[model samples]
Target: MEREKIKRIVSKHRHEKAAILAILHEIQEEDKQLETESLNYIAQLLKIPVANVYGLATFYSAFSLGKKGDTKIRVCSGISCHINGADEVNEALKSKFNLEMGETTWDEKFSLEKVHCLGLCSIGPNVAFNLVTYPKLNKERIETIIEILHKRTGDSK
Candidate 1:
């Protein structure tokens, strides 16, 4: 992330003490993940310890220190989702992309992750692609979603 961008985000909050999380969220949203350099710059701008910034970044599941793929897929592993066959959904995705949970593809196009819940239990076995939630997942449905994402991202495979 550029220093100017980080400065702009910090300036948006006027470097307020309470806006730390917001600042980080904006940075992460832009960068897809928090870089070490960005973390250092944020700490300096906020006049806080680097360790503090790092701690907060690591503590939140929303923040990722590693590079993320353009498409992020999160499968719900909550009780309802599990009972509804989330495991099967997960296995299908894993087989489709050759991805394990928390792993990004070598092409940097897709990342697969398991989340505790997506808060949409009425339609269990939910899957979130990027930020869009898909309800009532099955292997076939998941395949369709992946195909759509691939098309949108210009992935032939």
Candidate 2:
């Protein structure tokens, strides 16, 4: 599976060095995270050092070295969100899902992450679930979102 994905991404970018980031992005999109094997494969295909691939992957927050859940939730911790009770919102989510930042639920249905910003400061305290932004979050709203996700994913819990 990893080799096939790498081949497709390499082909898509025509193996150009300039397309490294795009190639990584496509790989991450498919795998939900970049594994060491895939990184080595990318490095071999691009004729770059594995260190270069590793460095690029580690430098970018968009890339994850660990496995991710089907649903990824990112809470904004920017100045605006922090001043607007982002902590409370985060706590509520953690409590509701029994998860911590950078953790996925045991069932692998959801993952929680804290991000610096969602780029929507005007609507502070933003939460994004699978890239869908929820602005001006509160504890009640968090619960609603979790329940909805559970239902949507067909999870009883």
Candidate 3:
């Protein structure tokens, strides 16, 4: 996005911190990461120091300066999941999507991660996207899962 556009968006926040947060959240919702450019633009427009924007972004896991994808894939690596073959599920997702853990794909379709647990151990070998968990998942599920997410987001990637 253009710096001027960001500036205008941030400028709309004025003295309302909540408004500022809301704007930043909207930006991230669209772009995933709040880049340095957006931060600078917000700072310049809001009359707030650039450090402040950076600080806010750093304080929140929701805000990422690194690459982020439309869908967040959190695979279970907990004991129960491991026994249920979560690793196999993880591998299938990785090979199928051609992505490494903690990495977002170039197409920005998915970001893969191994989370501690989604609290549904009985549904071992679980994989979740945006908190929607799929238990007893397998290789065959990858394509359908990605397709579902892409359909939801209207993103072909």
lDDT of each: 0.88, 0.87, 0.77
Instruction: Give lDDT: candidate 3, residue 52.
Output: 89
Which residue pairs collide, candidate 1? none
| TM-score rank order | 2, 1, 3
lDDT-superior candidate, 1 or 3:
1
Cα lDDT over the full model 1: 0.88
TM-score of each: 0.92, 0.92, 0.65
Deviation in Å, model 3, residue 29 alpha carbon: 1.0
Candidate No. with top lDDT: 1
Displacement of the residue 43 alpha carbon in candidate 2, Å: 0.6
Q: For residues 1-157, could you state the per-residue lDDT of candidate 1 as single tens digits?
A: 9999999999999998589999989988788789999999999998999999999999988888876778788889999999988988999899888888988888778888888988999898899888788999898999888777777877633
Q: Give the range of the ten consecutive residues with the poorest summed lDDT in model 1.
A: 148-157
Tell me the tens digit of each residue's lDDT in model 3 across 1-157.
6776676666677646567788888788767788898888777666788998899988875677877777788888899988877777888888766888878988786888777878998877888886578877876776677667667866533
What is residue 139's positional error in candidate 1, in angstroms?
Answer: 1.4
Candidate 3 global Cα RMSD: 4.1
